[model samples]
Target: MIENVAALAHGFAVALTAKHILFMVAGVCFGLVVGVLPGLGAPNGVGLLLPLTFTMEPVSAIILLTSMYWGALIGGSTTSILFNIPGEPSSVATTFDGYPMAKSGEATKALTFAFLSSGFGALFGVVVVTLLAGWVTRFALLFSPVEYFAVFVLAFASFIAFGGGSPLKSVVSIALGLALASVGMDTISGSMRLTYDVPDLIRGISFLVVVIGLFGLGELFETMQNPAAAKPVATRLDLAGVVRAALEWPRYGVALLRSAVIGCWMGIAPGGPTAASFMSYGIGKRFSRNGPRFGKGEPEGLVCAETADQSAGSSAMLPMLALGLPSSATAAVLLGGLMIWGITPGPTLFSERPDFVWGLIASMYLSNIVAVVLALATVPLFARMLQVPFTITGPIIALVCVIGAWTVAGAPFDLWLLLLFGAVGWLMKALDYPIAPLVLAMVLGDRTEDAFRQSMLLSGGKLSVFFASPLPATITGLALLCLVVPLAGMALKPRTARSAAP
Candidate 1:
């Protein structure tokens, strides 16, 4: 504990320097713009700015990108709270309750809660990162290919059960992600597995291209097509509401803690903030007096969902930083960003480059506070952006998506892939296939495949050897349960429905 404290102290000294703080502020400022604009997410924004960092010192570059990451994560809640749009993927659930509060004329208060609670949740998560990343890193390093593959199986199971609509369709999307993973040349052998004719296929589809198409590009198309779907203009808030939210802050302390706790658990588990936010909102509704009229405009629901989503987002950084396992699409891009900068994130990162680790850890604290203060100060300005017409907004979204995609590789091929995935994403949304599972599958597929093959080779092609290891046995068992629970639930559905019938 003392050593960790000492490290944090040193980190603060390094991070609080004027030069570093200015860079951190710049990153936060950039991230807020990225987060406010539809179709310009954290990953794309960071990826676009990564090259510019190459000329700077490694630590500064990391601080900038990582702060941008936290800023974007924090800024996403603003849109979710004020407009029904989620500026980023993780904030999607915040819209369930946040927008209602805005319509009810609690826009300033809702924005306040979102920003402050996000700061609280981020602190909770960063504390965990400081105290627990070492242990988590050790554990992560112990996993082999078979273990990772099993974990991947567990990851996909959630979509099957909760993806909504046809389970088969979700499964198909997962399969498609796996297929896309196979497009790259075989790493072990020189021979290509599925790259038909194109040389770009040799490296396979870029995850960023895929994500941009599915999210930014795809959403742009959807917005343009929905000509009749006009966005509601939000009214400006007086300064009084901000003060009111602060005065009521003490009352919601318990709820904030509750949401943060739930968010951490959800982040660490296979389920994500989408689940966490709804779960927290449900609890608030059941317990709070205003629960009955939650959708009609209630602060409790807004507080619950916003806090949970931000908390979950903050905690999601842990798996990626310590274990080299990205818990979300944004984290995956972050992982890629770290690699681009030649900073390999994992156990060795702490030991080999304490400056980078502590600097980043320190930046989290600085950025979290900056995000809250900046968001609160700028909420009024951001809230006005909702007034942009669909024609204008839709084209800007397309432009950002195209530019982000093109910047990924500076290749026309990536633009083509973006167009392709945009179409696929539209189809997936239309067909009710969950995009989350597809992203999870894409990010983990390569690692899982590598693990599976390595495990087979290690076992001398005797697959039974996989069951021999305790970790493998445990992971496989859990994965089996993940798969079985959905089927079992489906099987029991009819009997329960019949029994409940009058």
Candidate 2:
């Protein structure tokens, strides 16, 4: 324990360097800007900035990226509270109570609770990363190809099972993502599956292009359609309200902790912050003493949503760093960044690069503190941002999205892909289909297929190999149950509806 503390202290030494601190602040400001703008979540935000870090040292680069991630998570709530716009997808739930608080002229109360909860969630998640990532890596080392494949299956299964809205839509979304992922040449067979005759298709579609298009351009189109989205609500930052909310923290402490746990678990799993925020909101609504008050400017709902958003955003890094698995689309982008920097994340990564791992962990702690302070201090500025006309802001955002996409490989094809995916995102929103599942599948499909194929090769194509080991069997069973439970619920829905009819 003492040794671990010493290592963390040493990591702080590395992270506290003048250069690193500057990068952290820069990343946070960039993230805040991205987050305050609708449709630019962490994945698109990080993707946009990743190219600029190519010239920096790997450690400094990651510090900047991760700090940007932290800033984006906190900044998302700002727009949600003040404008009823979810700056990030995960901030959707925050708008439930946050916007209402603003409507009722209690914007300061909502902002204070939201920011404080986000700070708590970030701290909780980083502490887990600092103390638990090594142990998590140690445990992940025991996983074989079969077990790893099962874990991947479990992730997808959990999303399909517990993800709200239509299960059929979720399944279709996953299929679409998988189909997109299959466009590139097969790594093992060295053959093409989905690509047309275009030479650019050989490289497969860039995930960054797709993400920026879907999140950035798609959002721009929606905002363009709705001019009312740019209208600002009146807000006041009452210090007295902030102090009262702080004193009332104990009242919402249990809910906060529960939301944090849900966020952490979802982050380590595949559901990510969107799922975490929604799930935490549901759970909070279920158990809060103020349940009836929810969605009508309820502070508890704000606590649940904002806390889960930050917690899950932070905790999503655990699986990425410890096991080389991305728990969310943003994490997938960061994972790609790590590989770009020649740092392969896995069990061996910690032993091979203690400085990088610990420095990142230490930076997370400091970054959260920095984000909270900055976010609180800048609330008035962000409120003014709500008044920016879409005509001016929309064009700037569109240009940024285009540039971000084109920068990936300097390929015109990527720009086209961005437009295509942006249209797809718009259609999905129009159809009320969930985009999260699609994003996850697109990011994870290749790795999941690779893991499954590797397991099959080890077993000489035996199907039973997936369940041959205890860990694999257990996880596979859970995956199967996830699928079955959802199906069963759907099957019973008609009968239940008939029975309840008048």
Candidate 3:
């Protein structure tokens, strides 16, 4: 703990530079624009800016990206409260009470609660990350190829079991990603396997290009198709109202703590912020003294949702940094960025690049504080941005997507691939297919395959290698349980319904 504190103190020195602070402010400002817009979410926003970071130091680039994420998360709540629209998926639950509160003339209080709770949740998550970083890194160092493969399996299975989507669809998405990852060449065999003589195919598909299309263009298309017609609720933050809300914050202490716990657990378990917010809201409704008044402009309900959402958003970084397992789509994009910068994610990352890791951890604290202050000060500005027509923003967003895709490798071929994947993304969204699993698989597929192959080599092709050691055995068993429990529940649900039929 002492060492981690010292490292964090040093990290403050690294992150407190003028250049880094400027990037944080710029990132947060840009993120507000992205979040206030309906289609361009944090994942898409981060993907759009990734090409710009190619020339930046890894630490600075990450600080910028993560700062943008915090800004986007806080900004998402603004739209939910003022416009009855969720700017981000995780903010959907906030609208349940947030919009109602605004409608009841408590817009300032609602926005204040959202921003402050979000700040608190983010702080809690960062504290958890600081405390667990060393332990998780040490634990991960003990993993061999067998254990690594099992861990990857566990990640995928956890998503299937708890992702709140069709397990079959998740499996299909993972399979597709793995296939995409296998396109260029077989690393061990030194021969092209999936390329059918096309020059572009020889380089394999770029996940960055895929992300740009899947999130950026895909969301633009979706938003254009179903334009939001809600007008912003006219309101301004008053100092008196803000002070009143801050004073009343302690009244919902139970909800905040409960939601934070749920958010952290869900984040580390592969259930992302969207799930965390909804779960927290549901539990808060059931357990709170004001349960019956949850959806009708309850401040505690808004607090519950916003707290969990930000907490999960922040805590999801831990798994991504320590284990190279991204629990959310945004984290998947960030993981891809790490690989692009030649910095491998996982246990070795802590030892090999302590400065980078600790700097990022330190920035989380500073960035969240900045995000809250900016979010609170600029709520009216972001709310006004909603008055802009989608017709204008849609074309601009589409253009940005095109430029982002082209910049990936400066290839026109990626532009066409972007359109193709944009259509795929739109189709998947229409079908309610989970995108996180697909993104995670695409980012980690090659590593997972290499780990499995190395394990096989070590075990002389014995399938039992995964269960030979206690660590691998435990991980593998958990993966199996994740898969089986979900399947078992699905199988039993219909029978239970039939037996209960009158």
Candidate 4:
């Protein structure tokens, strides 16, 4: 503890410099812009800014990038609450209750709760990263191909089992994602699999393209279908109402703790904030005394979802800082940025560059505080954005999506792909299919395939190799349980119904 404290003090000394503070503020503001925009997300935002940081010192660049990440995570709640749109994937759960609250004229309370919970969760995660950095690094290094594959399996299985939609529809969505993911070349053997002789297919579909298409353009298309969507929502700003909501925090003590833990765990697992948010929201709703009120503008629902989203975003840095492993797409981009800056991120990062390590950690704490304050202070301005008609916002979002998609690889083909995926998203929504699992599967698909192939090669096609290790064994077992439970229930329903009728 003493050593950690000493290191943290050194970190603060480094981070508190004037230039670093300025960078933090700039990054936070930029992140907020990215979050408020419909098509631009954290990964794309960071990617766009990453090149600008190339000439700067590694520490400064990282501080700036990570603070932006913090801002983006918090900023997403703004759109989710004021509008029924999620600025980023992780904020999707917030819309369930947040927009409902806004429509009912409790926008101020919902926004305050979301930002407050985000701040609290982020601080909790940073503290965990400080104390458990060493432990987490060691544990992450223990993961092999088998373990990685099992983890992805667990992620998909959990989503399908707990997604609360038609299980068949969820399966179809996942399968669709996997099939789309396979369109690219086989990395291991350099063999062509699904490329229909198209040059664009050779590079495969980019995750960013899909995300923008599905979440951004898809939302725009959906909004255009409803004439009522063009009308401005009724939103009121009440600082007093915010205070009243804060007083209810004590009642949600258990939920807060549970969500924090869940978010931290998913962060370590590197499942990304999106998964953590959904899982936390599901768990919170399952156990809440006000269960039925969860999606109906419940304050606790916003708290639980936002808490997990923030915690996951913060803790995701742990793996990247300590073990050179990135838990999310944004972290992966940051990893690339670190490499570009001539800093090797791994176990040696702490020992070799203690100042850098600690300073970045310190910045995380500062950034979280700054992000929350900015979010709250700007609530009225952000809430006003909802007053704009969707007719105008829709075209603007479409343009942003086009611009963002083109920037991914500077390819015109990405724009075409974006439109195609957007159409898929619109169709899925019309059919009441859940998009979360599909998105999750697409993000993790490449990793899953790579790990499974590597494990198979190592084991010479022996399926038993997956169960050889304790961690993989446990993860795979849990996955099987998640998958089987839903099927078992479906199978037994007929018998139970017949017996009850008799």
Candidate 5:
């Protein structure tokens, strides 16, 4: 381990190259800008900048993209805390406590907590990715199509598990996403399924455009319905005071450590950052002495949520780089970008492209440090963003969504798709349906379907082939555990209730 650290330390010397450093800076700046805007997420930021990386080397490209990822992970808390609007999905839980603290004139403390927790969580992610990457990669190789499909089912199951108002509504959202993913030409048969006589539909709907519209444009439309509440306004806070009172800061070692662990596990579980953040927050609240303070304004809860979010954001890269599977939406976009660059990611990638992998690992460390500096330096400026009335801000958000949707395909058709998805998003949101399932489906639906069919074909149509291998059998056992245990608990609930009633 010490030897590995020393080698990574050497990698840092390379990360500090004059050119890579500049890209890191650019990423940090761009991240802060985009992360402050409600509904605009890290994936959009990377997609917007993807074309610019065409001329750069692979190492530089990874550094630039990963730096932006880290920066946005840090900067997202600003909007959630001060404006009660999540700039990224991962930061959504932050609003529960963060905004209330800001409303009570503790914006500076909240921001400071966010910055420190994000850096700590990200560092933890870097360490996990560096040390356990090989083992994790090997574990991923065990995933056949059935296992991958099972994982997808579990990931989408979060919609029902987390859905607050109605399980049926959550199922609806997941079904919609799966339906959208079904559009376009079939990769296996070369047959168009749902083009509806349109050439663009033949290629399929880019999830990028749909995400931008649903989360970005849809947010704008939703906010417009309640214009006054959507209004943003500046608030005053004393950074100096917060720093001076640092001794009074919450004791967050346990929270930070716990959230990091939770984030790492969730990232590996394939549910992504949204689940990590919310899960961490829920756990923190459950364990807190002042659990009731969670949504009302609790520093401990803020630290937990923010830490887990950034950790999940950072660690999600591990599966993408090592296993060639995206653990999050942003990683999925980067996966596309890597494909465009003709880079096939997997264990072989580590062997064939050690420099690229090492450089990326090095860049993440530097990016974390840079994010802290940038977030702290821009606090005064970002704090002012809260003051901009929703009336002025709403139009800007809508315009950015328009640009984002248009950029995905360089066509007007995508913009219309944006509006359509935006409506869908708004409706799902209104009905308390979980949005993560839709994104997860849009991401893994096709791959899951293809894998199942291919596995059957390779086995000569023998269903038993899925369980013939040791790896597959073990995976089956786990899947059964995942499904059966949950149902067992549900089934036992009424029996326990009956006994208690007697």
Candidate 6:
């Protein structure tokens, strides 16, 4: 540990140079723009910047990319809070409470809570990476397809059990998402399952397009239908509110810690930030004293979702760095960049290039701090955007949604899909169906199916294979508990009330 600390100090020296700091600022600025624009996510941002880094030194190149990642993460929550649109897939959970909070005239508080918690989560993840890198790498290596499947199941079960709605309705929402996810050609079967003779369907639907339709266009439609709702709600962006929100951080200590732990675990494993955010939000809803107000502009919910999302995104870098396994799409791009730079990832890389490794880690600390400052500075700008007359902002949002949807694949077909799903989203909201579960299912459905099939193949169709190992068995057991306990509580609730009746 002492040696790691010493090396990290040297790394800070490497990352603190003027040239590297400039790169960090530039990367963060560009990334914020990428993140605030739907359909242009971190992975794409990193990929676009990859060619530009080809001439730079490896450490400088990496610091630039990673800084952009932090900036993108912080920026994504801005749209989720103010516009009910997620600039990144992992920001979806933030929209649940963030938009509601902003709509209730607390945009400053929501943005402040999100940025502060995000900074905390990123720092927590970096601390883990600095201290426990070796242990986490080894633990991550223990996960097989069976364990991966179990983890996905556990994520799903947690959401369903604690999602705070009709369990049956949640199930229905999940089923719809899964069905939508399966529209493309089957990965293993080499045949189309749901294309139904449509060539465009062969490539499947983009999750981003669906999200834009559901949250962005859908919200627009609702407002258009009710002109009264189109009137901009009063919102203030003041230093006082930001300071007050920061001061309230201590009140949510439990949520911050829990979410950070969940994010790190999911990042080290294969759950990714999207799954981590959803799982954290679900668990937060169940455990928070403000549980009943989760979907209704609760600050605790914003803290939980943003904390887990940022932590997971940051910790995901560890596996890509130490084990040659990319835990997320952006990490995969970073891994590619490492390979391009002639740096082979694995246990040996740490010993072979401690300077590079530690420098990247140190940069995470600095970059996240920069991201938070820049993100906070923009809170007022985004808050004031909400004050724009709906007639103008609404059309602009719709046009942005349309452009975002078209950018998914440059296919005209996605435009129609956007409108269809927009109407579907409006209908679902009207019927009071939970949208988060559906989004979660859509995100994990394909990965879960692939993992499950691989596990089945390994076990030759025997279900006992999941229990053949301690890790998978424990995770599967926990998933079952998550499913059963909440349902059992619900079942007993009515009985207990009857017994206590006068």
Strongest candidate by lDDT: 3
TM-score of 5: 0.86
User: Which numbered prediction scores highest in TM-score against the true structure?
Assistant: 3
Candidate 4 on 289-358: residue-level lDDT in tens?
A: 8778999999889989999998988998887776555666677667756866888766667778988999
Q: What pairs collide in candidate 1?
A: 145-451
Candidate structures ordered by lDDT, highest first = 3, 2, 4, 6, 5, 1
TM-score of each: 0.89, 0.93, 0.96, 0.77, 0.86, 0.64
Off by over 4 Å in 5: 1-14, 51-58, 103-105, 142-154, 157-167, 229-239, 245-250, 289-296, 480-502
> Per-residue lDDT for 1-502 in model 2, tens only?
5656777898899899999999888888888888898767788899888877777788999999999998998999998988888888889999999999888888877888888899999898887777786688889899887888898788778778877666677789888888888897998899987788889999987677878887778777876787674555754577787788678776888988999999998888877888899999999899889888989999999999989888988988888887777877788888878877888778888788989988998899898888988888888887787688778888888888999988888998898889998898888876767776777777778878989999999999998997887889999999999888877787878466335423
**lDDT per residue, candidate 5, 1-502, as tens digits?**
5654765776787798999999999898888877886556787677667656767787889898888888887888888887787878789899899988878877778878888888888889889988876676667676666666555555555445543334455567768777888899887998998888989898798877877767666666776787645443335456686585355554778888999999987776676777899999999999878687889888889989988988888888887777566767677777767766778766667667767877788889888989987887887687676557778887877787788677666899888988898887787666666666676667666776787788888778887875787766665556565545545555667455234421
lDDT of 4 at 227: 32
Task: Tell me the whole-model lDDT of each prediction, alpha carbons only.
Answer: 0.75, 0.84, 0.88, 0.80, 0.76, 0.79
* Candidate 3 vs candidate 6, TM-score winner: 3
Greater-TM-score candidate between 1 and 6: 1
- Model 3 alpha-carbon drift over 4 Å, by segment: 492-502
Q: Alpha carbon lDDT of residue 460, candidate 5?
A: 88
C-alpha RMSD by candidate, in order: 3.5, 2.8, 2.4, 5.2, 4.3, 7.5
Q: What is the TM-score of candidate 6?
A: 0.64
Clashing pairs in 5: 231-390, 232-390, 233-386, 233-387, 234-387
The positional error of residue 291 in candidate 4, measured at the CA in angstroms, is 8.3
